[model samples]
Target: MKEIAQSENIEQFSLKNYIYIDKTEYIYNLIKKYDRVFFSRPRRFGKSLTINTIGTLFEKGVEPYFKGTWIYDKWTQNTCPVLHLSFLKFSVSDLDNFKRDFCNEILKFAKTNNITDFTDDKEPKVLIGNIFSAMPEDMHIVLLIDEYDCQLTANINNKELYEKFRLFIREFYAVLKGEKHIRFMALTGVTRLKDVSIFSVGSDIKDLSYDHAYSQMIGFTREEIKKFYIDYLKLGISYEKHIKTDCVTDNDIEEFLDRMAEHYDSYCFDEIYENKVFSTYSVNCFLQSISQNQRVIFGDYWYEAGGIPSILKNYMESHEIEIDKFQTSEISINYDDFMNPTSLPYMNENVLMCQTGYLTLKSEIKPPRRIKLGSANREVKAALNSLLSQKFFNPDALDSFYDADSILEKGSVEEIIEHLNKVLATIPYDKYPVENESILRALLLMYLSGLRCDVRSEQHNFKGSSDLLVNFKTRRVIIELKFSKDGKDTDTLLKAAQEQIRRREYGIEKLGDRELLQIAAVFDGSPNMRKITEFKQIG
Candidate 1:
């Protein structure tokens, strides 16, 4: 922790300290194998850092900067001309301004490399060609572009503007189609447009976004955490008031890792699903915060760091995306279709969510190129729930929502029922249509997820499934919901729900010495009334 300072400049920090893990061998192998590579990952997932690392390696050979890295002894190639471009701060509001600025950026890079055979051309495509032509014939150049799709994603809502920009980008990138002097090239972005010229043209760029070999290249793996940040983990545990310092054991550290994984880990990018990594940005932020404050705190650091991508926020608002559907059921889509989206304007909401990091692959690649997607982790789920609740429900009313952790720990069944009723009353009538028990369960799950508890829907056992289950510390609440649009009485519905929970033996095996609370709730699903009518404890 002392070696790592809080700095936004990752390049400088990485070069100066041992805090950064070395992945030079992996990247070097990729460069040696592929001439052109395209990668896609969510925002703030170290794409920029990866680009910079490659740029530095090619521009300055691994003498002083990468002295002890894996590639130091094996980098046999001489340093060559490197052209690095980053679109993270590009202004794309106007086409004319964008063109002028883009050309200037290329010219700036060209001038730094002492390639001065450039005409005063405003066209970016011409400037790029001139730069390439001016380079020495024997020396091949390495090109690294970060956030290549930033312009298109920014203007996705404006169809006319987006099309115009897309045409310009396609033509501009088409200049690299037959560049024989390119030693290696790589482009990284949040989404990979299917028909874009960068992929559709003659350029043989391999998309390594879902390649299992590189899935753990950017993010921090669990083993990496244990190897690099074990001291910080112990520090966090020491800061925990409930854990005594003298009695700290290996089990305490394992439990702390589990809690941290719930909030920040479990992001599966590839189909294999064998290796899941935590968001690098989120893990760094958490460690930095705890180090500064001397306390253990788990927050939505990733979501809070970048809020939500404007593209995703706009898409969710414009489309009638059923947020509950993703929570209630497994969302499976073709792997090819999900990876190579045709266009951003008409892209599927699930694809957009997956690209933007709200959702991630939940299962391995199944038959027929199908994969299941869900919320990346608990932090992501809580962030989405908070966003939707703020958008639809009254903010002030949300403050009145029960303290979920406290109530689940010590409150009685009647208190839990009252909490559920209060939470349901905040939902607007038209926003949520309680048509069936599943819908009701999904809605409750969505709202309850925002609290500090492990809330799940459709908990299955050997016999059947329970509607909802909420676990907080030492207490677990298993809820069975019954919805009735016809003329079914609350008493009958409650009895049926209780019978189902008992007959299914829900929570019997899972309840290992912890106190369990079973609830039976009946909701009135009529058009005029969509609230939980009555609820009581079944066991």
Candidate 2:
């Protein structure tokens, strides 16, 4: 940012560069109400920077860093021996080395602060409180910890490590929980993780994750979006029309805001409220994209890219339940079900993903709540789709990639459909029974979707949508598959299929002979797809 590069601190006005926007005001406001604060946000959502700014304001040093920010005017320059410790580095593999490693780090930190009270064989928690105790009588102590879940979350599968690390951390945090030499305290992480457990001393500090009051404290709000658009017009984004109508313009706006919304947005704390959350990662990426002319979004590098999906794929493939219809109820309606760090590991990924801005909570039944992967942000969706369909996937593969022209021009539709049918026929009815036709359609979509083309089930039509439709440029085909399960008679199934097709307007477009079309019938009258029925297009 020009503000960062230029020495003219007085001229620096807006925070269009880093994650230093709303969290500053948030910390300042919280400092007024609560002496001790524990805030949970997904990683990289400006927690560290916020804490850093707090140190600059209240700590002993105030040089170039505290120049033009709003805190300068309001800050009384309180002389406090401030201690900044990051929880992310507490990561250890095993229990024995873990304790020694953490203790050594704390010792080194104490030496840096001119504190000599710590000695071997002493509880680390007691030493942590001494950080404040050693401060001069003239100065108070401000403690800031970022990524508070690191010690407990990292290498969570190792029970021995977790128990030891948990106890150590519980003791370390207990010093603060007990309010020992603690003033203007703040702790940051992705989730309010301690509802089931505790760290030692204090009564529960306020958790604002689901609180409606400070919802906009961490990310850019819709109003803030308009302000940014207005200020940065050279980006060529128009928010005027949206302002008149009390809406944000989706068209012609640089995909930056949209991308920001997708990666971090759609985090609705309350089930009834429809507010979207902007992730700290995607917003920063957008700013960098604008600065360097590189378009990026949540999918490009927000968090773990191909890894999580592949992990989920492997688990679903190995399991008996059909992956397509897999729901949270299958996992006892627990969002943290994905938190397992083994086959499909959840600890690092879950906490880190949420903190780094990839996944968010969709809803909560009671304790943990339901976590979903993708954002409901339209801009973020567009940004990701552009990257995933074209950026991530290779363009050279024809039957391999989405450029369907190569497939329609060079290959036979009949052969393709027949090959797909052969594969479909192989799926044993006993292995994956048709719980419902919709579920069957979803399974078919999953299999067909893997083939590069934009394969969609329940394709939108005049009356409704088709069961499946694949549009490859000029070559378009609509196919309707039917399955009769259990006690349902063939006539009833056939009628339902016909009505669905008619309602969905499957053949309304009228494809020529150059295009191959099939109205395939998959009869699951018995346990196998032995009885077959076929329908072909005359055109």
Candidate 3:
């Protein structure tokens, strides 16, 4: 019944009654295995908490805070001086301010540890070197750097500024390369920038980004969720008005988890693709919502909590990124290519998108080893579609597009078609020319994704693939699309589409307990003037 805490600080876990999913076992093993580690994951994946945990272990010695954690008894009670630096804490608006602020932070760390006789140099590299030189030979410090690539990611759009910051941070990190006083070092960031000295200079630092063992280090595994969140899940089920009973069944609990997984799970980080963890922050937010509202609402917690990452937003605005391609088609990249350091301005958009959490590792390919990436989950897919719709549709059109949700729930074929046509009319024809069936399907899928329902395209069954399938609370709509460039008879095209759906038996296996509504839609006119000519329920 206690509130779930959202603080990034590990010390606050107990103070704030936070349900801390114990990943200390994994973290303890990581510390024992690697002396230097560089971990790159998308934002809000708990990189800061991971950093704070490491800092807590080394600097504060696991005690009252980590009583129930795995590392509490395993770790020695000996504490060491820690230099914890988070780039997020610094002002990165300009070069001088960044340098001065970072230098002051280093000085503050040095002063905390009682290291003296350091120069007041504005250069971060000089300050770090001074601290290293000033430290006693017997005392080795633990270094945990959080958001190491923050400045670079923030200035990615500005090539000149980005390069300057990159060079400076590279030099600053390079100081730690061969420093004997550094007992252990860990750097966490959203990206692994190319030419950073920390990776290339001295002894190799292990990158655990793609390591299978550490994939679930920062996120909530299914087992963890089942063990930790069962009470909240049961409470949510109890509050459901439709259940109408005090006793909850196992199927009820599992069905709730299934919905949660659909919206929040399936973020794969390793090459093996065996371990998929739910978004940690999103899971917490969902549980918090259930606790506060006493009702279960599977909302877009991750995307809603942190809107499009700034780096991704800037990349999208500046680059010619085909937003539809990523969602509509299969995407794969070589393992080596994906792991390699990405440079700015000329960075691979797909790689960047994967790094920023827009896409996640879907599966692994052998022979010529590669990784397939796709939308992490339903929440991400819907968020991406909503973003795409905003880019292509005006305010009025967006309102009309969202209104389709209510129209869809009513199961009115005519109303749904009218709303779809209104949304379609607002598409910028100059940029997105609907020339063929595939384009029309993609556009329709984009709009349908915005609706508060489960929308999927090219859903394959035994017979064939359905163009689009939408699942409402009680109804399943199977849509078959047909398009003609020449002035073909709309009625004929509509009938053909209907026959294809019936002949193929699309979504027949999926009609478990819900009412099925099969519709055939035909689009007529040229690329610029394409509009839905007819839509009819294929009863």
Roughly what TM-score does model 1 have, to 2 decimal places? Answer: 0.89
lDDT of 2 by residue, 1-539 (tens): 23111111212223344223434456567677777666666544556666666666666444544454555556554566566777666545655555555667667766766776544444556656565566565545677777666655453455565567656666666566656456777777654444224421345566555555566666556556545433332242323233432233445344545545544467554323455556545554555454454322224334332223322233233333433422111212344443322211233333333333333445442446554443334333333233222312234433443423354334564645454444445445555554665656654454444333445566665677667776664566666767666534666655566666656557566455445353544455455443334333323
lDDT of each: 0.77, 0.50, 0.80
lDDT of 3 by residue, 1-539 (tens): 55677778999997677788898999889988988999888888899998998998888887778988878889974789888888998876699998888888888888888999766688889878987887788979888989988888887788888889888877776787768998999999988766666655354688888788898887888789878888887888888845533577888888878888989998888767788989888888888888798788888877788777778777766777665577655587776567665575667777887787778887863436776788888887887776666666664745655666667767488877777788888877787667778777877787778554688899999889999888877778888988878757878898899999989987777588887888898888665447887888887
Colliding pairs, model 1 = none
Better by lDDT, candidate 3 or 1: 3
The alpha-carbon lDDT assigned to residue 448 of candidate 1 equals 76
Which candidate wins on lDDT? 3
Candidate 1: Cα lDDT at 308: 64
Instruction: List the candidate 1 regions with Cα displacement exceeding 4 Å.
Output: 1-10, 14-18, 241-252, 365-367, 388-432, 460-465, 473-476, 501-517
* Candidate 3 weakest lDDT stretch, 10 residues: 194-203
Q: Please tell me which model should have the higher lDDT, number 2 or number 3.
A: 3
Task: Give the TM-score comparing model 3 with the true structure, all chains together.
Answer: 0.93
**Candidate order by TM-score, highest to lowest?**
3, 1, 2
